[model samples]
Target: MQATGSSHSLALRRGDFTTLIEALDYAAKGDTGVNFYNARGELYATSTYADLQVEVVALARRLLGLGLEPGARVGLVAETSPHFVRFFWACQYAGLVPVPLPATMHIGGHAGYVAQLRGLIENCGAAVAMAPVEWMSFLEEATTGLTLSFVGTPEDFDRLTPSTATLPTVAPDSIAYLQYTSGSTRFPRGVVIDHTTVLANINDMASHGLKMTEQDRFGSWLPFYHDMGLVAFIMMPMATQRSVDFLGTQDFAMRPRKWLEMMSGNRTTITSGPPFGYDLAAMRVRPSDAEQWDLSALRVACVGAEMINPEPLKRFAEALAPSGFKSTAFLPCYGMAECSLGISFAGLDEELQIDYVDAEQMQEDSIATPLDPEEAQKSKRRVARYVDCGALLPTFEIAIRDEHGNDLPERQAGVIHLRGPSVMSHYFQEEAITRECLSEDGWLDTGDIGYLANGRLFVTGRRKDMIIIHGRNIWPEDLEYLAKTQPGVNYTDAAAFSVPSDVDQQETAVLVVQCRERDEIKRARLVKTIASLVRSEFGIDVVVELVPTRTLPRTSSGKLARARARLDYLGRRQAAKMQHQPEPANSLPMDEAMPQVRYIA
Candidate 1:
């Protein structure tokens, strides 16, 4: 991928304002513009503005008749479907705020889904909670005792009356949507972005960052609830008057190849997902499959929303190299929901910049001193590779600040602070929490640690979750990655965290590995192997525990909730000490037998 510098910019039209309603009007003009696809590789639906306008108008009228005021919050719960899209548009057309609720976890079972739904509806203060008919019984139980104005299924959408109330013309600065931060319950934050903010983020990303064209086709299996899925892929195409090919999130999960196939089949020029998604597809896309499909047009393959793993990116590039995929085409970006999606994006066709730093210096001085990978191998606290997240989006400003809120110099690790028009207005009604993050002039404390090098941003890890052992900041992702290398482990199935030891003055880092192996001998071998690997590689002592798979807590976007995992671990330890309850598969125990290692004083 060759870097196409700032020379690329598309002129914005006056009518093509920040409001989504205005964007939809432009998309509604043409027919044959693709909208959605179901499993089995079929294009299930297509809609022009002319067609969607009719449905949105009727739905708007029905919403008004419900006696809810304009801008009342409506909760949306469903997998990617035409109804979800239609209802979303209807909310915008009728001036209702749509808060997208997370769907059920595939592995969390029914209880987990119910708990998630309950939290979202309660947080958003929804006047209506909507889902499909199959989910009605569960929704009823989940939403019990909430002040729900109405609860309906997708079928009820057809029954909406043609709108008679005057459509409310909202300002660009009016609240457009709410994006929830993907974290544990203790750190739940809703990014409240107005229409102007959303529009600016989208336009800047599409025009300058992504370099999107009307001829470019988009494809994704990412859930609509995720920021990348909702704003970048689904909504950006409509905002830019370009067509998108979407695969259902469930379908893609069930059959990962469908994502690659859709890209190959549709000749999709743009698509984005995390490193795991790429790894999944690369693993499933077999030798025989290559001759049957073509992916010559794929352009911007983005990696974000989680810790950027360079290994998977490399493997994906090698696997698809035979099919005309370039390694340089991989765009590694860094963002949070608080910033309305994108903060920094790599250049269009640039190779990912990875900085190898002295790990000991990083922890002791908070400065990432460049180190050779060879030299790092000999030292106990040696090397760590920090992936550059490219440059800040055209309209956003970023700074690195120390604990005292003083700006730091280049290559010095500190909290990544951002101030931009695209940043959220505030956390929803949580002024205290909002004030803690946002400054008086609108800069937000991202709570992430990184540094600037050669005009690029390099993300280290979340400051709150950083593991300190013998004065070294060991990133949990690094430990979790090593744990995953053990057999019988699933993706995102391990949690590496720090726990306060009874005797140690500081925290003792423990790794909880989830595996399907139940045989005691096999489990012991796995645990011992993990411990040996950690000690040999990082020169750190760790407690390794083998638990059942699919037990780690995950946020709405399918990310591991590290903070929640630590709490769960502590609770299990207390219960075990009390001898009051048997340990459940959901919570695992770590070995307290390992001796702590000594560090150079």
Candidate 2:
């Protein structure tokens, strides 16, 4: 396929543009539609819009031959490849719902991931599971005891025979696909999205949001399992009849600069990832590398799918300044899979809006009170500042609600409630959750903490009490499960929570593992082991602390209290810092019987 703009020359323009099938139909007319690249940033396979149409038809025919019931779910667990993109389009054309499972390998305990997949398949009633050859090993293990109908590699995709008659017809409101929610459980929640919802979101993004065009060359390393990756980068460009260059998540993780190298090499104009990604790349970039790269074409660099940190953006921009990269390219967006990807984005070609507020007032009053530099100097009060996440999309409605569900005014922190055309219809077979999320009038609760100021949305924190490390959500239970495997550690002996670090205000996870043994060396080794396990399994750094058994307070029902543990950990750290400090010049030391830990303060 051609590198960029020259696509969208031929194709039907009308119909439910909201669906992936429709996006494929439009992209088929373009001279260049979808492009895939290898780990070295070299083109591996190329296909024009016209070629996509042919490949999709044949693939859809083969899928239909599988004898899957109408609307049966087909799961894809492979990384981004020509096959991955082709199958997605084919599923749309063939009237089957394609559930794109995350391609990122689960670390620490693989069994947990398998159990999660089993739950998703059971919930979606998936008829087939497919992956690349490398992924087949995990698929086999995951599906071993289950009565699954079919499981194979991508090569087996072509072996499908088109049997019987044409595939079932689908309407605009028909379910298109199911994206599983990331955190809070081992069992994933399947988000049901429809054709209407998809198109409405894409159009809103392309027109009022990002203003994407045929000239834009998309580049991404986001996992295909993610909403931002699947809907925004993969489907949206096709919906707009544009071509995009793809990179694998593992390749990007191993060599983040490859993402920038691709953009520099291809003169690609758009890309997005979490703050950690930028931070990683920034750390690795030397002055020499910047001199060799030219990234002037970059227009939109979206930051989302995790906590947004401004420091990384600043560091990255400064590191690449010689390469003509502008700080203005950093776009902070707020979205979730439940809303089909994007709900709000920082306006393109506009200056970012940041507010410096008193942190104490924010916690106590839930009010964002801006403070001057002078007053900030006199108090221990710190400033919490962030770039505005722009205004809501045209088809979306946003409101902030208090604990009583009453809407709050601007600058007041509250839960972000929204209703939009892009919102998922429901969680598959989960009526209670569906009702709890949706209002009687049809709004989807985004489970995010934020406020509106001058019509701009600024996200503060997540109300869900989940930890998002390295762009992947990990529930406290998942970590607790791993802790129980270690000797002397039980489910009740582990408490996992996210804590802000001194280096950066963004949260880093701290896992406290309770132990009966008081041996300092043994305790230290366990801490190191837990940290290593977390790092290797999830590609994230964790701080592991050991507490004496019975020290961790529990509830009346015998459940571990995560919130209380967080407070206790904070208290311990504070006390430790105080013990190291000298006594006041005029003050006498405390009594010998008093707690020695108090001396540090």
Evaluated with lDDT, which candidate comes out highest? 1
Error of 1 at 118 (Å): 2.2
Each prediction's Cα lDDT score? 0.76, 0.73
Segments of candidate 1 deviating more than 4 angstroms: 1-16, 32-34, 106-108, 185-187, 378-381, 487-491, 503-505, 580-601
Model 2 collision count: 9
Best by TM-score: 1
**Compared with the true structure, what per-residue lDDT tens digits does model 1 show for residues 1-601?**
1111111133333224769888777666654244666678777776654577678777877887787887788888856877777788788888888887776574457887787788878888889878877677777778999888888886775675555768889778878877777767474666787888888888778877788765677788888888888888667777776667778888887888778877887778888888878887888877778667677788889889545878888888878877788888899999878877888888888888888988767777888899989866666456778887899988888889999999999999999999988889899879999899899987899999899998899998888888988877788987887888876675567788888874665678788876666455666677778888878867787866565555567766767788888887776677666975443433323333321111110
lDDT computed for candidate 2: 0.73
Q: After superposition, how far is residue 362 of candidate 2 from its true place, in Å?
A: 0.8
